[model samples]
Target: MVMVEYMDNVKLGMLDGFLTRNHQKSLKSLFSRNKSPNANDNGDDDPSSAALNSPKSIPQLSPFANSVVSRCSKILQVPTEELQHHFDTQLPESVKELLTYARNFLEFCSYQALHILSSHPDYLNDKEFRSLTFDMMLAWESPSVETKPQDKETTCSNQEVEDEDGWSIFYSSSTNMAVQVDDKKTVGPEAFARIAPVCAAVADIITVHNLYDALTSSSDHRLHFLVYDKYIRSLDKVIKASKNALASSIENLQLTEGEIVLDVDGTVPTQPVLQHIGMSLWPGRLTLTNSALYFESLGVGLYEKAVRYDLATDMKQVIKPELTGPLGARLFDKAIMYKSTSVAEPVYLEFPEFKGNSRRDYWLDICLEILRAHRFIRKNNLKETKKSEVLARAILGIIRYRAVREAFHFFSSHYKTLLAFNLAESLPGGDLILKTLSSRLLLLNSGAAQHDLSGSPHAKWQPKLSPVSLIALTQLGFMLQKDVHLDAEAIIVGDVCVGEINPLEMAVKQSVLDTGRAEAAQATVEQVKVDGIDTNVAIMKELLFPVIELASRVQVLASWDYPCKSTAFLMLSSYFILRGWIRYILPSIFVFVAVVMLQCRHFNKGKPLEPFRITPPHNRNAVEQLLTLQEAITQVEALLRSGNIILLKIRALMFAVLPQATDRIVLLLVFMAAVFACVPLKYITLLVFLEAFTREMPYRKESSDRWLRRIREWWIRIPAAPVQLIKPDDRKKKKSLDDRKKKKS
Candidate 1:
């Protein structure tokens, strides 16, 4: 008997449901119409696809009408015109379907509207109720957006006026627009009158399950478990079938084309064909089908579950609501029925590995394989003219892959939110249960600590993570470490630094120095020159440009996360500038100051100075050291050039790092001018300025001597000569030379 019942469930309704007379007319008109840009906007495109049409014509119209009628019958006790007014003049066919869907959904609420109508004894006898139901039917019947309200007014003639206290209501008036018949009464806006009832009706419908329980007074009259289970199984099968159908259709549509060739050169090729053009056809509808299947899975899953839970069971037999949905049914089974049977678990395949050479890798691999098969088909049949068409197919395949990835990503993000509704319904406590579920999900996502890093012995077993997973984990780490609670610096340092100094950390340090502080500014000139970090500065500068470009890209892809990108750019750029100023410009300025001060002191001490000479014991070595230091300083000076200065300023503007009190605009300007003057001439003028210029110039001879020392220092440092380091052999040779020089002396 059970087998027979199951077999009976496979009964097919004709394609008749799809081939309605109105649909046939619409289809005929669709083909007849030009569909050109200048096509007329008459009723040709639409032929009364209204939910208000004859209930018998549609596959599932009776349930929809019954639901609405049950709700309207109670509300209709109020005058017909007033009830009609609440519908807000004439509703569009789309809105009418929404009303119907809302009404059907109300049945899952436990038939609250039905009980309200049945309990109100006067509701049935009321003539206005009948008239209002008729008016509602008319509201549904008028199919086109082009259908005027004036025609509806004529159809539902309004003559009777009912008065009670200050309220005067007209019954189904010709122009059903809500108008004040009572001079003494105050009415809310017409828009409010129309929308408020729909909201209330929806709310009332949502509350039906509780109302049904109250009305029925039977705990056993809840929902059936098997019905929803069957529906869910069937729906899942339908989705899979749909997917398979689409895949098969796509495979079958492959087109073949013949090879063609063109030679630009005059010399003819010996080959039979110059080029083979291969292609495969793809339907645009496949993309639409994919989208529809995804949404259908979501919707049908919820609906089937609702129907399962709304089933009523007494001692001997199971009774079910006509409109129970999948979600409500699932809720009923888990919460009320509380069955503990071991059901056959539905099969869910594992998520495909997204980083590998296999077919299970990224969807891109699958798409490329499909394209290859398509190319083979075209080549084999010699129908290769459809190259562009094949290209479009490949492009569509890529787009479809992206769409699927995006859908999966969205599902991953909000899977809990959608599933939570069902889970919350199942559990006794709402929010508390949700919290527990959330905690569990977080733990699962965190995964196990003992996941195998080394290759596991089991051949069937895959790695716990892939390249995409690592990338995702890195992104997740970034998000988690962004706040003040986590050490963002440590995380960045650990990840970016694979072997040596962290590029990100080095960039950040450079930025901090660029901002300039007391310690940085006070460092000795030689110390600054020796510790000069041009390599880091250059790395940071180059890194910053990409970061800036990345930030702009981030703005396009996900604008909300853009501040992070901007900060990355600004930090690197600032570091580059800071290293330049402290290492190069500041050192030169210090040298200048030191020379000026020495000149001042010498002049003040005495005028008994011999003419400046760099010849022996009193001179050249100190000058050579100074010159060597100067050369290093000059290299930095050249780097801190005008073009770079302008680049930094422009970068600063583009990044929008507003200049504050500590930004040192004046210092930057001064350094730019100094670098421009001194860097090009090997810092020669800088050496002169340091040597001769002084505030106290009364002793002119001392100033001149200071100038000579500075000039000698500058020349010796940069002269073209071989500076040799002595190895063991060189040291022995140097000692012999020294001994010979001593003997000669």
Candidate 2:
């Protein structure tokens, strides 16, 4: 009878192996020690069920429980919604269990028959029950499986076994226990055979709640801790696995018999700091890469913060043509000479009243002392290298010396009065300066006497006009002056609104102008006065020639030019004054840039004999011509405001024609070629307009001539073109040429 039963059992086992090959391995590892493998099989009908009741050979399942928990914990970190959905369609796990595991709960079985209750179709109808079920799923942990009517203990027979070395009592053989029969399943057929049919019967009770829906529905605190802890732990493992690329070393880091997770040891290094920011698992490939980029961005931002505080401040002091060493001393000497000349003037002659009290007085003394130290260092025959130190000491002396302070007091009082006068006029009356200047110029040009113009016939009538009269009377004279005023006003508004100067016009003009200035300045050598000898004096004269030439141009600008006249001159003067006072306090680079800009402007705009001028038509009244000029100015100004603010039409025209226009490709091509040729930064940014538009340009040809030719062709094709002159004789000449060509052909 035992032999027949054994044969029947073997046949059943083989069939089971075929049915659950995949789940068998896990089941063998999970339920291998269950004494009653057929505990719920209702085997009163099957004779072999009685044979399975022996307990001697059954391995203990308690040890495998931790391993099962650990495995689930690690898997929970993965994007499991898709996987859970797949399992839902393929397997028979309850919806609650699917969601609980999907949510990565640390404990999954705490709520009473949660999966069973959630599986009912009617569960959705009871909002409260559904809500409660969701909360349980989020926070659930394992509990003993619910007791069932079928859980009755069966009286089993005990057996004895004899081996070569020993005799033993066998309650059950290993074969009869939950031993793996195939690689198809995690739990054997014997384990689920009893549960499968029961689960299938409860299909009507199943719900399909996913982790996302569960989490969305519930806000339970207990569930949060379980979900988060497990999720984080799962993430830690996932990150580690990802780093290792799911290699074999993962398996080698195995747990002990009953242990679920590997314990942290002194040997293994801790996880990176970024891992602790959240209570969620490590991200997948795309998310992980994005996270790494964000971390890098944060690191860069932190470094930039330090740069702003420390390095940027220092950078402001460096990168200057001025204040390097020798150049600063020369500027200081010039300033002292200017101060001394000014002190001899009528306004500055009486300096006594200023001696009592003033901050301006204090700063002036500092400047004077610096100048004195600089002179003293030279006069006493100090070492050339030590001159700067002495100058610095002289600066300190001005700050501290009493006699210097009195001189400073006079200078400071005069400076303050001048500054206040200029500020009031420049800031408040600035609105009217250009208008007044234009009106004054227009009046000068219009020769009609005031008394003679009072009741003349033309008083009631507007006069006839021509384009030339329009250009001369309005734009070239009156309207242009008004336009300057309007432009200045617009600039102020723009600066306030945009929080920056609109250097577009200035930048465009400077683009070409800078090249000229740079070349000229470079040609000019540094100058030093020679002692005693006639040859040394000649050398000094030669050395000083370039600077004298540049200074002469500045004098012309200071004497003439609308932008530098009156208020303009006063504004620039005050700028220099303020600059001198704060030279030590502020960075030398700022002052250097300012001075370079001034010198460049003077050379470019204040040169003798300007090549172009706005001439009037042959005949027209000054008033009519002025109105026409005003309209033209208005149109041009509007165009400038709309686009390419840096290049006004007049300036663009000047850039086109002036400055030896023959085959030079223009600033744009020159800039592009330089960039292609990897030019130095100072030269690189010389052409501001070109630099702005083509900043990201890839390298191309370095030949400026080729580049220039192309640019000229492009410029000719552009929409804006200057008006051309036509001659009646040219038409006759062209006809004859055409006739001759036809005869030749």
Candidate 3:
């Protein structure tokens, strides 16, 4: 009776399931779409080809699914209706919907089974059916057999469909889609698809078991064990299949003329061609051969080709090791960065620990050995050339490498100095330094006999003088002293042996002797020039010659009596001209014009420069003379306290230390100006127009007081008429009112 029942189930499965006329039609349609005329012409009897051509449709009464379902039902003694009811009440809305679909599909299966059984009565007693049924009931479990007609016009070639139960649908080919069921997300479709029907049957079995337990208050351990056993077997099959596929992929790579030394599972980063950004990681197998390194992605099709790196061609490439941290240890310990000569950036390959050894270190050592061997081979190949020629070429290569390295270092240091120059040039005293140097240059070229240092005896001493010493002497007003001797290499001012000319330290020391506090100044200069004074002092002395002369001129101007107004005016004009021309020509001209305009306005407003209104009566007494001397002392103290003289001295000292500071700053500014000039002229004109329209003018009414307002108003009237035509009535009236108010007070 049992054999008869098995035979009946087998016949029903074969007649109503995948072998049915409808399934054959679907298979024929799929084959026709993929078939070529050449494939039809070949009558190959290969088992693999036959298997590939076989219909992949699933069968009804599948051994894997049906066995689990039948065993659980028999143990629980639950009807199909009871299981469905339990599922409806206990499952979520989504699961309930899936249950409904399954039930509808099962009803269709039953109707078809009945139709087949009625039509083929002779299949009931077939021995072949009985044997096939027994075999299926024992162990047969396979994937589903749902067939959907392929849409050739579909835009999406490989759309992924997934469900909440960790079930995924993959397009197995352009004409077919397959479903896979797995514990986690990483399992391949082929493995899980083979067991998908079994999974569905297990779901049904579990529902029935739970329902029976709820009703009887008893758990069926036998049914539970059977379900778990089937699941474990299914997972085992998946693992074996995955390993086989991996081996097949590795074999297909076809490495060139080398034995594989090492093979490991790892990941390599993939970057798009042409684009410079966005790297994606692909998990793959890494194989190191004697001749090359290869990486094959675990996936099929385009990914199976595997990227190859030839050891000989990439001899100069460097491999860098990087530790990605503890979290990344699961995937890899260290990543190897390979810089390809053809690519803009390096490609990274990460390796996990392989068999208790560090894969990164092992791979790196292998690559180093290969590189060393390649270098040796290359060296031997060069024996054909003359030894002398080879030696000369090698020497030239070494020199070129060193030259490039030193040039890079020099540029880096100078770049830092250039930045410092830019920062200093923006300060207020920076303008003064430039002006002072310009005036000295002008004085030297003006044919002034007193300023001609080139023919002076002290000119010879200038070469020996360090910039620090020159600065110290200038600060002490030594340049203006008449009793200075420069006949010898040693600088001498009066009786002092200031400094010697040979070594910079000696020169600076000798120059410091001219200062009143020689010892302290010498010590300070030594401390500042600690990093070898020769280069810095020589560069400074050469570049800042004009600045030193200007410092002397400043001292001379300060000492002058300015006995007449005309003399003082002429001196002030010359100073302004020299300062303005060097630092900022346009702005200085505007300033000078503004000053002259204000003076003219003052004259037109009937405001004359007045002398002191109250003066003490002249006295020839000694007490009066003493008072005058005390007043002079107070004025000198005030000038000193104001810090102007000290600031000027500091500026001059800075020039001595940074001799090329002005030149570097000017060069940078000019470069920036040139860059700006390259912009469209219209843009510059627009910017200037906008500034003029929006910027607050210096002589605006809000900024001016009553006296300034009168002066500006007088100037405004001059442009409309001659000087006499402008009326001073308003100014005179205001002045009279002010006088009356002063009298009343």
Instruction: Give the TM-score of each candidate.
Output: 0.15, 0.15, 0.19
Off by over 4 Å in 3: 1-251, 258-261, 266-278, 300-303, 324-333, 353-357, 382-745
Rank all candidate structures by their TM-score, best first, as comma-separated numbers.
3, 1, 2
Sort the predicted structures by lDDT, highest score first.
3, 1, 2
Model 3, 164: alpha-carbon shift in Å?
45
* Model 2 error, position 338 (Å): 70
- CA lDDT scores, all candidates in order: 0.28, 0.28, 0.34
TM-score of structure candidate 1: 0.15
Residue 238 lDDT, candidate 2, scale 0-100: 33
Candidate 1 has its poorest 10 consecutive residues by lDDT at 258-267
Compare candidates 1 and 3 on TM-score and give the better one. Answer: 3
Tell me the tens digit of each residue's lDDT in model 1 across 1-745: 2322221111111111111122212212321213332222463432222212211222232433333433332232222222233332322233235434332222211122222222222232333333333333332333223332213332213343446631123212212212311211111222111211221111111112222222112213321111111222232233234335444433333211211110011111221101101121111111122101010111222211110110011112111112111322221111101111221221111111224212212322322223342433343332222222222222223322333223222121111112222222322343343343222222221221112234232212211211111112122121111121211111110111111222222332343234245334546443423222443344455547766786667444332234455456445544544444425767787898899999888886876545322222222355675786798889888888744655654555445454441255456678878988767443444444333332123345466667778866743433232235679988999899999999999
- Residue 259 C-alpha lDDT in model 2: 13
Please give, for residues 193-265, the per-residue lDDT of candidate 3 as tens digits.
2222122111111112221122112112111211222232333333233335335544666743222233334
Any idea what lDDT model 2 has?
0.28
Per-residue lDDT of 73-113 in model 2, one digit per residue for the tens?
Answer: 22221112222233344322332353333222222211112
| Model 3, position 472: C-alpha lDDT score | 21
In model 2, how large is the Cα lDDT of residue 409? 21
